[model samples]
Target: MPNVVEPKLIAGNANQPLASAITRRMSIHRGVHIDLVDARVERFNDGEIFVEVFENVRGEDMFIIQSTSNPANDNLMELLIMADALRRSSASRVTAVIPYFGYARQDRRTKPRTPITAKLVANMLVESGISRVLTMDLHAAQIQGFFDIPVDNLYASPIFALDIREKFKDRMDEIMVVSPDVGGVARARELAKRINAPLSIVDKRREKPGEVAEMTVIGEVKDKICVMIDDMCDTAGTLCKAAELLLDYGAKEVHAYVTHGVLSGPAVERISNSVLKNLVITDTIAAPEPVKGCEQIRILPTAPLFAQAILNIWNGTSVSSLFETSTMEPIYEGVFRS
Candidate 1:
């Protein structure tokens, strides 16, 4: 909290509770003369999005909190409009604090005639007057290059590591950390090293979207408790399929730790019906109703980590130290259903 400038924070409709939580950790409260420029969004009969911000924001350091989650286009548009409004109102600077940056997976052209949607989103933000962006665990680390402005890509690993230590204390040898896809091996490997466990990979091939066939396992997983780790879980296709495959490969139990829970389409039903014992996701995006009701799924808040990061940035302190390997003893054993 050193040299704090008391930057003005604003919230959008995407995930107000998360915004409020982050604010509380930063010692800012609601209704403390905070101005909310009304984002009057209306949908036309044709299902189009319209947005208007109704407050004058002259010379303020504006931080707009909006996550590009479900209805990705609408939420994205809302953030853009809010930035435009603040820009025209003479706001000194505008920072878009999007915890769950949507369209991040489309970081590059995997096939012919495919658009790099992540770059497009970055361009849109820049065009809409966003001076900077603060987000976490992007689908691809290289996506940061898409933005010309300063983009702070925070890590939820510290938060996830803390929870893991508390949940799996001893019997670490019985556990194996898994990356559901080859692209995520680094992420899973890091978590595995932190927990003093072996790393495993699910070598799967996708024939098309939302369909995966697990071909092989890359590590020793027989009769061991497995924990799959990923940046996000959207349709639950990859995670669920990996879990089932792990079980078939003699994994005693399977759990997954994903940062963003986009839980779109039949994701909830898929996870519920899969072989997963538990699915832990961070509150980057507000989880939908069916996802919340799923018995095997649990949500942990990331407000503390983000709040601390904000404080560090405001005070010109280093946040890289937060990712240091944990020295604490482990906490849970065996796979947990919740």
Candidate 2:
């Protein structure tokens, strides 16, 4: 057998908790002690970001764990700087483990003279000397093609499927998975198939960014509990509107399972007053105080899933097999229960 190369994990300020969790799971799964790099990220008086990697990463396989979420520009710049620092330090390879790839929604141009910011970000990473990228549940699947390096797009469907099975085990017959919009029908349909539930779609019109117009429920949701699925919930406008429409259509209850809970603007307030029973989201983007304090929200940790993917990548194993939800066991039960 060839020698196994252990990866050096580095954490950025984007989401420290998630980075820590992933580090812990990696150490446990490998049965070997692994530590995150003592990297410091701070800003000078003029607000210029500074990054310093304290450990020697020369000839090492390094993975920088950072999610370009809220304060997207700051976190994104931090990632680029860190990658540059690692590359200059003589690291053999640098893999960016961005759990939540921001600016992914702007993958294409809707109007003339517009920019494809997603592709731009990809170019920036490549120019910064990143060898590969590992991200999850991109807003648009085609965004992977924007990257010149090897990109591994992980899915949150298996994670969500496990939770749905456990939560609605007894009432699976009365459950129906719904797509908040036509674009998310494929995602919702996959979840519905996993749990053996009927699928529904919400036909809605979006006049502009962050605004939803008239919405129409296309399937039979009357008397059935609905599970609305989407890639992300930004302002909650579309989610709230779809929930109200579902309730008006005589749906017994509505719940949501979204990958990224951007929850910007009045999202928390809207969810608090919305007709949904619960809004379940992964810890891709750290939940703010309002989202944490909200009684209607539940957070699921994606660290274990990410940890397994990283391990598979390091071992030259198949990463797609990690999507086998039925065969996989949950590792972060305490965090989810809490």
| Whole-model lDDT, model 2 | 0.90
Which digits, one per residue and each the tens of the lDDT, describe model 2 over residues 53-159? 88889999899999999899999999999999999999998999998999998999999999999999999999999999999899998998999899999888888
User: Residue 304 of model 1: what lDDT?
Assistant: 63
Off by over 4 Å in 2: 1-5, 330-338
Residue-level error in angstroms, candidate 2, position 57: 0.5
Error of 2 at 275 (Å): 0.9
Candidate 1 residue pairs in clash (backbone atoms < 3 Å): 167-332, 168-331, 168-332, 169-330, 169-331, 169-332
Q: For residues 203-278, could you state the per-residue lDDT of candidate 1 as single tens digits?
A: 9887887777446788888999998999998789888878888988999999999999988888899988988999
Pairs with backbone N, CA or C atoms under 3 Å apart (clashes), candidate 2: none
Model 1 clashing-pair count: 6
TM per candidate: 0.88, 0.96
